[model samples]
Target chain A: MSDPDRVLLCYCTCPNPASAQHLAETLVRESLAACVNRIAGIQSTYRWKGEVTSDSEELLLIKTTAGQFEALKERLLAVHPYELPELIAVPVERGHAAYLEWVRAAGGD
Target chain B: MSDPDRVLLCYCTCPNPASAQHLAETLVRESLAACVNRIAGIQSTYRWKGEVTSDSEELLLIKTTAGQFEALKERLLAVHPYELPELIAVPVERGHAAYLEWVRAAGGD
Candidate 1:
């Protein structure tokens, strides 16, 4: 079994399907992520500057290992349109072993 | 600042939108989760009965506290349709402070 902390699920939001698909494909193709799931039509409310605003956004659930995170983040920033995109990484505590292994293996060093 | 591990982003999949909405609303109403983001139209490939299968599933991105996780998991297990639902908790390492605080405050003790 892999160390739970080794795997990460990174959360990021994109303005549309085009950007979302591009980012997801980039991560997987570059071996920076095992898989990326795009969740569409989400309403996100956040305080930007001084006002609270809500926007329709697409969420990308990027699955990768800790070792691949820095590179992943760098790649995301290079292509993502937002000046400061939301990139939060959450560490997995426990998961289905087989699936976890698949995730770990998918990101080749 | 909240301990990074204090906030959990639980991942769970539902067969359809109705079940996903039900689960998300239940957790928020019961104060077990601060919020739940339902991601519709996801393709999940997994192994079942020694065979690989892919299914269209809705993914729930549940935000809650470590303090509320036990109760949250219990409620999820009781209400989730699948005999064995995927309830994986991932600990947030970092996030926008205000957003993280909002997540913490939404769940009343």
Candidate 2:
């Protein structure tokens, strides 16, 4: 079914590991995400406020189903520390069936 | 344009940072991807060969347009160390117009 493929891998960046871990735990505890992978040692380069900027940031890869996206985004915005956090969703095209099911179940279906 | 929206954020895991850096550089130099973010300290848990397995792996968040996905996958497969690597693609739903354009241009669009 398309349901599993509709699972999303959401990406966001945090200023530090503490905030990143806090957000990740909250999302998983609230069932907004099945799992959240916190990645450290990421150097991001981008343009901000008319200037080219770069930062050492932690990245959060949040996994949840499409149906939960809106709620997840709302919660993320409410707690995220950034003025304009990078909240991007990408569809999971394929994966192991059991693992995908585990993700769905973790997101509280 | 739709082309920019068609940009992808491909995710994969490598055994170590050296392999990850090698792949990332190769992808960029070959124009298969606009950028690749290497994140260390990733803990991946999944079922493998009838058992659940976990590993500390480096995650590669690869950015490229949709058109380059096939070639990128092919190149990745040819060089990846895993017997069955996790090659997943997620469509970028939204991003800064300028940044998205930069990604497309980097992918050789």
Candidate 3:
């Protein structure tokens, strides 16, 4: 059984579907994530250089473990288009036991 | 200034867009959430009753605070359709200060 506390759900936004899919596949294929769920049709509103900006973006919910976060972040940044991408990890307080295990195994840690 | 540690990003999934939108709006309008971002076209794969299942779902990225989590959870459960809804709160380790404040004010605490 995987430690639930170590499980993380990292959130990031992509400019388009192709890039999102590519990133998701790369993460999963490289075992950096157990699974990557790409959510389409999201509008992000935020501040950029003192101005409020909105953009249509695809969100990537990357499932991995805390142990792998550092490496995952490095790899994501290397390929990501944004200068400052949203790489926030929210700890998974609780989840299905089997599903959590799958995440651990997929992350290869 | 709102303490960063008190902020939370709650994650949940709905069967469709309307319910997700309704829940999101209700949370924001009722001051239970600062803002709710809905992402459409997500596929969730998990196990249920010893069987693996996959479903098309919409994900809700709910921004709130730790101080209001309990009430938020109660309200979410009351209106949520699932018998066992996925209400997971992930701590926001870091974020843009201004954006974080927006979340806090929107959640009303």
Candidate 4:
């Protein structure tokens, strides 16, 4: 299997559907990403300002290469409404050759 | 030094927050994961019925050992309202010794 480039997996969440869709399409259409998988129905529990809080949020798993990450972050923040967009990147170790190829074809610089 | 059993990563989403939290708790309370990191703001796109469709989904990265996966899958489905819960398991190659140790300690049969 042709090893896929170690993908940078980014995570994010939105309170409303419009912002979620908007960010996803913008990332994909611009070719900064090979693919963008949006997931919803997240109940988040965490400490904010030293107080425990819980909220319903939608999470996004973004797939891109390491090279484009900085720019991707900039783009996400430019449009994202949240005070702190959950932008974390993980490395893709391996994947089915065909699937990774599809990702590469889908990506744009 | 101890080796943490290779973890199984399961991805999921809930249309509503209740389902998300409910499913998460069931899995964790039963000790299916060392930890469940909840995130939000996801916008997903995929092809369904020959048409490209998109929606918001909260992807749950359920961290557990490889052995508990079968049971984990069963429990997630039992509590999950979705027809097909997005349950995909990926292996952990390496991790910090202390963190993996916590995972092992957190596991339950």
Ranking by TM-score: 1, 2, 3, 4
Worst 10 residues of 1 chain B by lDDT: B45-54
Clashing residue pairs for model 3: B34-B106, B34-B107
Q: In model 4, what is the error at residue A26, expressed in angstroms?
A: 1.2
What are the per-model DockQ values? 0.21, 0.22, 0.22, 0.17
Q: Per-prediction interface RMSD?
A: 4.7, 4.6, 4.7, 5.5
Q: lDDT per residue, candidate 2, B1-109, as tens digits?
A: 3454388888889999788777877777677876667788789999878999999998888878878888999999998999898889767875444556776766663
Ranking of models by lDDT: 1, 2, 3, 4
lDDT of 3 at A81: 84
CAPRI quality level assigned to candidate 4 from its DockQ score? incorrect
Judging by lDDT against the true structure, name the best candidate: 1
Off by over 4 Å in 1: A1-5, B1-9, B14-39, B43-56, B61-87, B91-109
Q: What digit string (tens of lDDT, one per residue) describes model 3 on residues B4-105? A: 338888889999978887787667667787656777888999999999999999888887888788888999999899999999976776444555666666
The docking category that best describes candidate 3 is incorrect
What tens-digit string does per-residue lDDT give for candidate 4 at A10-66?
A: 778877667877888777767666556755666899899999999987666776766
Q: Give the per-residue lDDT of model 1 (tens digit) for B1-109.
A: 3453378878888999999999999999988888899878975544344343446789898998876777788898889998767677777778999988888887765
In candidate 2, stretches whose alpha carbon ends up further than 4 angstroms from where it belongs are A1-5, B10-90, B93-109
What range of 10 consecutive residues in model 4 chain B has the weakest lDDT sum?
B1-10
Is 3 or 4 the stronger prediction by DockQ?
3
For model 2, state the Cα shift of residue B26 in Å.
Answer: 16
